[model samples]
Target: MIDILLVPIVLVIILVMLHSYFGMEILKRGIIFTDLAIAQFAALGSSISLGYFHEEHFYLLTLSFALFSAFLIAFASTRKLHLEAFIGILYVLGASGIMMVLSHSAEGMEHFKSLLASDILFTPPMEVAKSAVIYAFIAIALYFIYPKLSGFLKELLFFSLLAITVTSSVSLAGVFVVFVLLIAPPFVALSLNFKKPLLGSFIFGWFFSISAITISYFYDLPTGYSVVFLGAFLTALVVLAASKKALEN
Candidate 1:
C-alpha cells in the first residue's frame, strides 16, 4: 500500500506547490473562472485530437487552444466588459466545441467523460516527471521574470504561463481536478486570513489531497473526484467558519 501510494502522493504535492501561488494571484485579480475556461479549451482541443487519433497525447493541439484562450482573457481583463462574463463565454464555447468534435466518434461520450476526469492512478511515470519539469521551469520564470513585466506584457505573461500549466494539468488530472486545485486551497487560505496565503494554500492543499488519495486507495473511489470533493468540502468549511467568526466579531 505504501509503495502504491508513493507516486500519487508525490504527484499531488508537486501539483499543489506549483498551483497554489498562481491561485493567490488569480484570486487577487478576481478572475476566478479563468483557469476553468483555459482548461476547458485545452480539453476541447484534446477532444478534437481524440476524435482524429483515438488517443489523448495531443499536447501541442491542447496548448494551442489554451494559449488562444489566454490571449482572449488577458485582453479582456483590460477591457470595460465584464471579465467573468467573457470567461464564461469562453468556457461555454469550449464545452460546446468539444461536444461538436466528439459527436460522431464511437466512444464519444466515454471520451468526454474521461476528459472531465481522467484516471490518474494509471498515469505514466515519464509523464509525471515531464510535468514536474515543466512546472519547475514556469516557477523559476515567475520568480525571476514576472516582476519585471508591466501592463499588457504582465497580463500576457501571467496568462500564458497559466495556459501552459492548464494544458498539461487538464490532460493529466482532468478539468475538475485542475479547477479544484487552482481555486480551493487559495480560497480557504484567504478566507482564513493567513499571513502568507500562498504557503497556507500549499499546505492545506497537500493535506487534503493526500488524505483524499489515501481514502480513494482504500475505497476504490475515483482519485480525481475524491480530491475535488475534499478540496471543496474543506474550503467551504473554512469559508463558513470565517463568516461565523466575522459575525460574532
Candidate 2:
C-alpha cells in the first residue's frame, strides 16, 4: 500500500507547494475564480483535441486555450470593467463550449468526469516528475523574473504563468481540484490572519490532501474527488469558524 501511495503523496506535496503560492497571490488579487476560468479554457482545448482529433496535439491545444484565456484576462485587467463578473462569464463560456464539443462523443461523460477530477491514485510517476520540473521553472520565474516586471506586461506574465500551471494541472488532477487547491489553502490561511500565509497554506493543503488520499484508499472512494471534497470541506469549515471568531473579537 505504501508503494501505491508513495507517488501520490509526492505528487500532492509538490502540488501544494506550487499551487499554494498561486492561491495566496490569487486571493490577494481579489480575482478569485481566475484559475477556474483558465482551467476551464484549458479543459475546453483538451475536449476539442479528444473529440475531433483523437487527442492529438493535446498539450499544445490545452496550452493554447489556456494562454488565450490568460491573454483575455490580462487585457481585461487593464480595463475598469467588472473583473470578477467577466471572469465568471469566461468560465461559463469555456464550460459550455466543452459540453458542445464533447456532446457527441461516446466517452463524453467519462471524459467530462475526468476533466472535473481524475483518480490521481493511478497517475504515472513520470507525469508528476515532468510537472515538477515545469513547476520549478515557474517558481524561478515567480522568484526572480516576476518582481522585475511592471504594468501590463507584468499582469500578462502573471496570468500567462498561471495559464501554464493550470494547463498542466487540469490534465494531471482536474478542473475542480485545481480550483480548490488554488483557493482553499490560501483562503483559509488569510482568513485566520496567518503571518506567513504561504507556509500556512502549505500545511493546510498537505493536511487535507493527504488525509483525503488516505481515506480514499481505505474506503475505495475516487481519489481525485476525495481530495476535492476533503480539501474544500475542511477549508470551508476553517474559514467560517475563523470568521465567526473574528466577528466576536
Candidate 3:
C-alpha cells in the first residue's frame, strides 16, 4: 500500500510543479480561465469517447481531444472577441454536449463521476503507468519548447500545459484540488519572497502535497479536500508572516 501510494504521490508532485509553472505564466498573462475551460473541454471529449472506445484507447482519445481543445482556444484567442468570454461559452457548450452524450449511454453516470471528481485511491496500476508516461511526454515537450516559446507561442504553451495538467490532475485530485495545486504554491512562494521562484513554488507544492496526504492517511478526510485546505492554510500563514515582516521593516 505504501509503494502504491508512493508512486502516485511522486507523479502528483512532478505534475504540481509543471502545473505551478504554467499556472503562474497564465495568471501573469491574465488567461486564468483558459485552463478551466480547456480542461472541461478535454473531460467532455474523453467522456464522450469512452462511450465508443475501450479502456486501452481512453488515453489516446483524451490526448487527441485535449490537443484539439488547445487548438480551438489558441485560434479563438487570435480572434476579435474576448478570449475569456469565448472560453466560457466553449466550456458551457462542451459540458452540455458531454452531458447529453452520457445521458444516452448506460455507463454515463460512472464515466461522469470519474470525469467530475476522480477516484485516485482506486486508480489501477496500468492507469498509473499510463499517466506517468503522459506526464513524461508533457515534461519533455515543455523542456524543449521553453526556449522558443515567446509571445503568442508562450501563451499557447501555457494553454497546452494547463489543459494537460488540468486533465491529469482532475483524474487524481479532481478539479478543486487541481485549482489548489495551481494557485497555492505560487502564493506561498510569493509571500515568502523566495529568490528562485520556481524552486520556491516546487518546494511549497511538495510540502503541501505530502502534508495533505499524511493528514488524509491518518484521518478519514478526503485526500483532495485535505490537500486544498492544507495548501490554503499554509499560504495564509506565509502571507501573514510576510505582512508582519514587511511592517517590521
- What TM-score, over all chains together, does every model reach? 0.95, 0.97, 0.79
Say which prediction, candidate 1 or candidate 2, comes out ahead on lDDT: 2
Q: Point out the worst 10-residue segment of candidate 2 by lDDT.
A: 240-249
Per-residue lDDT tens digits for candidate 3, residues 81-175, read: 78777878877876787788788788898777666555454456676677678778888888798678776676567567667766776666565
Best by lDDT: 2
- Candidates' C-alpha lDDT: 0.89, 0.94, 0.72
Cα misplacement distance, residue 159 of candidate 3 (Å): 2.7
Per-residue error for 79 in candidate 3, Å, reads 3.7
Best of the candidates, TM-score: 2
lDDT of 1: 0.89
lDDT of 3 at 223: 68
Off by over 4 Å in 1: 244-249
* The 10-residue segment with the lowest total lDDT in model 3: 114-123
Residue 13 in candidate 2 has what lDDT? 91
**Error of model 1, residue 76, in angstroms:** 1.0
How many Å off is the CA of 12 in candidate 1? 0.7
Candidate 3 clashing pairs, residues 3+ apart or interchain = none
